[model samples]
Target: MNEQQNKKKWLRILGNIFFYGALLLLLFNPTAKGWFLRQLMEVGLFRPQIEQEAAMPKQPAVATAFAFRDATGTMRTTADLKGKVVFINFWATWCPPCIAEMPSLNDLYQQFRDDDRLVFLFINEDADVQKAKAFLQKKSYSLPLMTNTGQVPAQIFSGTLPTTLILDKDGNVVFRHEGLAKYNSASFVKQLKSLL
Candidate 1:
């Protein structure tokens, strides 16, 4: 082949390799997926827009009964989190959207980790706790990780990955969002401050 033709062929091969490599990374690596999502957020995608309830009810319609075990194997429940702003996020390792939004969730967690009036629960829906822990540790996220030890409340998790529910101090569902969102947005922090 001529010199120019050989250069063109090599370029095409390198392009293909890069494309496939990125595809595999997005598919298999949770940290890569989270980084990609954060990039998208930088360009205005998945901007956090919290849907506030028109009238904050005294209690949630669905019972908030739930029990989950933390990384230290300590059992906890929403009932135990009464009188505090509880943020519950249901996610799984294989879920692309869940992985994508995790970094923003981590940022949100960092902002409130020191607050005694707020509690954040990152509930891993995957049955394998070790795999979930590995994912979090690999990403170096400090968010509180938990796995459901008992039946998850239907109101909290309706078989959806990346479902988030914010409960008020009285344990009423004040905001609920399904799918991916930028949890570190200013509006979201303002909403949480309002509750606080």
Candidate 2:
């Protein structure tokens, strides 16, 4: 074949390859519902939706400031707990999960309460002082009980009772558990012990 004719043929092949590749990319782009597009969608939006869903996210609120006063009117500022490992558990007087887990919670608190490097917060979610006080008296748990005064600190509860958050010494949330946790579950205990 003549050199000029051969050159033209090679050009046509390269042009076809480039054009087809561009068309494939545009056709399979996100919003096209194609497999590649679906992957892109999952990476761009769907994945986060699943991760940030109402379920327990890995990290809870650690850097945010939250305050609640003890029944005796003493103030507890979350900022003050920054250098310590902090566990904030949200409970309500009427919650069975909260009641059932009380003993274990107390045990955990007692073991770590005196440790200046660790702090535990038993935050009651909108539980009336009378009811909470009555229950605490019956349980004989000396841990401080602080009720939610209306503003949520981190939405850690997502408006539900019995959510728990664990913060590291640096004030970064390392664990978040939603719902009633078996206070002594191996996984939970392991995490707690690791913090200590």
**Winning candidate number (lDDT):** 1
What is candidate 1's CA lDDT for residue 82? 83
Most TM-score-accurate candidate: 1
**lDDT for model 1:** 0.82
Per-candidate local distance difference test? 0.82, 0.64
Q: What is the lDDT of residue 98 in candidate 2?
A: 62
lDDT value, residue 4 of candidate 1: 100
- lDDT by residue for model 1 over 12-111, one digit each (tens)? 9999999999999987887688778768877888775444452545456348758888879898788888889888899998887888888888999988
Report model 2's TM-score to 2 decimal places. Answer: 0.62
List where candidate 2 sits over 4 angstroms from the true fold: 1-63, 185-187
User: What tens-digit string does per-residue lDDT give for candidate 2 at 1-196?
Assistant: 9999999999999999999987776555422223333343334322111123324434433535567776677877776777788788888766655665566677668767777877778888644677777878887987778876555555445777667777677666666666554454444555566676
